[model samples]
Target: MSSPPIITSSSFSSSNPFSSLPEDVIRAHIFPRLDGCSLASVGCVTPELHSLSSDHQLWSHICHSKWPSTTTSTLTHLISSFKGGSRSFFSLSTLPPNHNIPSPSPSLSALPDQIISAVDIFYRGKCIFSKVQATETVSGWFKCSPFRIDLVGPKEAVPTPISRPSHEDTCQNLYADLELSWIVVDPTGHKAVNVSSLLPVSVERHWLSGEVHILYATVVCGHVTCSVEVTCVGGGPGGLVLHVTEACLKMEDIDGAHLNGRDSLVVLQRVLEGKRGNLCSENRKMGKVEEGRKKYLEFLERRKERREKILRREGRLDNLCVMIGSFLFVGLFYLLCFY
Candidate 1:
């Protein structure tokens, strides 16, 4: 302990350089440089350090910097390989439920809940409609004619309500011409023949009182002809009362094929007939009132004109009488002087 190990302030200062440096310089310079260098050596490091390589946000930035056009699925796959944890934590493979992207499977009956349920039906992402058949219960085999379709429903699906049919006892109106054009992509590369002003089949909804229902458009595949029939079961304004039916191309036909999983087209029709009826009724009542007001105004105008004319005529008659009386007085004075 001869020289006390030559204790010097310079050595202490060198050893504790970070203690004297500013916070920003330490974070900006030292941390990033250290982190970057550490990240570069991450793959060769221990298991704990390798797990940090799975930080998707950090890798996502790197990935975007490298392959800017990488798709979600690709990035997800790459991240999954680096990640040691379970797959559920960072799912790059699946899209958000709100994207409304259709799945390849048919077992999932309804669309994602986030999609605007009552969207104007689109076919293969096109907003136009073409001839095809849809059914309420899609069972085995059914036949349908070409037609346009539309819906008069809520912005979202609601439970079907039970109620008696507003009309008579037995008959039902199933479907109607939506007056919309149905466009189909020729997957077979055959040019689709354009039909000008084809008559649309009038379809109606069959509301079964106390039931939940939905409306869907058709996505055509292959060389199948389709048509839709709407059945209004028996529901009033407060029920889900519409039904759809579907028909497909025959099983053994590839000449015009039925492309599997073609989604339905959803068309937004004009205002509901019930609302339209109410509007018409209100318009008729308003028309009658307006007509009555016009008639009353005209009557008042005519009465005022008649009164003014009568007053004018009376004033003219009074002036004529005064002139006559003055002349008659002059004549009397002249006759009396001649006598």
Candidate 2:
């Protein structure tokens, strides 16, 4: 058997694959299937395809398709407000958040007066909930209180196919499969950041209440952390199906205290500008998730070290105080005896 000649980008002699296809077919049928990175790669192939791939509609479609929650009117407006429109927003949300670099965070004014959160949750590939929530950051109460964005109202719950589990094994079996994407948009900064770990870092079922809490977390700046907690309760038809009653984002410092609104906004702004540390960047290697988990572990260690330092400093202070008190007592007794 004879070997066939290798097919290169120019192998077709006169016309390439892109040149042979009708532009409409590629634009309408083909380009939409490619994700942002794939679309960028396709653009690099040739000049003709590059033009088609550059279509704002295609990038916008990719954004909407990946995160359905962006279709809301408010979210749509925010997306349009991004510097390069949807393409810029998409790039911001998908890139790795390089969070641990040693640099001062931006001022609170970097945050918009109003911020938008587009959250999506999936269990077993089915979208359980998608919502866009607006939060007021300009108020005094927000600046002084603990920072939190509640995606679900207290009275309502989003029902799911998952049933309440009677045993611990059954309850935790689905933790690894849950997916979440939480993108926070600051319209004033013209930037957005994905604060979700893309998968559950931990899932717990309340022992007495039986409420399942699925937690997606990202370690911010090595010492700080951002987390989205989905609290699912049993409900729907005799309370058999799992109902997600609450979903919220919370930021915490090394002491585990909830970051106040002012502090939280600063961290958020830094996260928006930080470099995404993606050490495990191989395909199917759980890229960002693994990196997130690793950073979380490091954060724990740093927290421990901080506590130890504080304890050691306090111990030294306590010893010094005791020595001073004993010396004063001895000197007073000697003076009284001598007199």
Local distance difference test, each candidate:
0.30, 0.79
Model 1 per-residue lDDT tens digits across residues 1-339? 121122123422536553466645533443333222234344234343344444544545443332222224533343345333212111221111111122233232322211111112222223222223222323222113222233333332222222333534322221121222222212111111111111222223334442222221221222122332222333335443432223112111113233222132111110000011111222443353344334334444555676788889999999999999999999999999998
Backbone clashes under 3 angstroms, per model: 55, 4
Q: What's every prediction's RMSD, in angstroms? A: 28.2, 4.6
User: Candidate 2: where are CA atoms >4 Å away?
Assistant: 1-18, 101-104, 107-109, 275-285, 319-339
Question: How high is each candidate's TM-score?
Answer: 0.18, 0.86
For model 1, state the Cα shift of residue 70 in Å: 25
CA error at residue 149 for candidate 2, angstroms: 1.0
Q: Can you write out model 2's per-residue Cα lDDT over 263-332, one digit (the tens) per residue?
A: 7888888887765532221253366678787787788788899899999999999999999999999999
Runs of candidate 1 with Cα error greater than 4 angstroms are 1-165, 169-177, 188-190, 194-199, 202-226, 231-237, 240-339
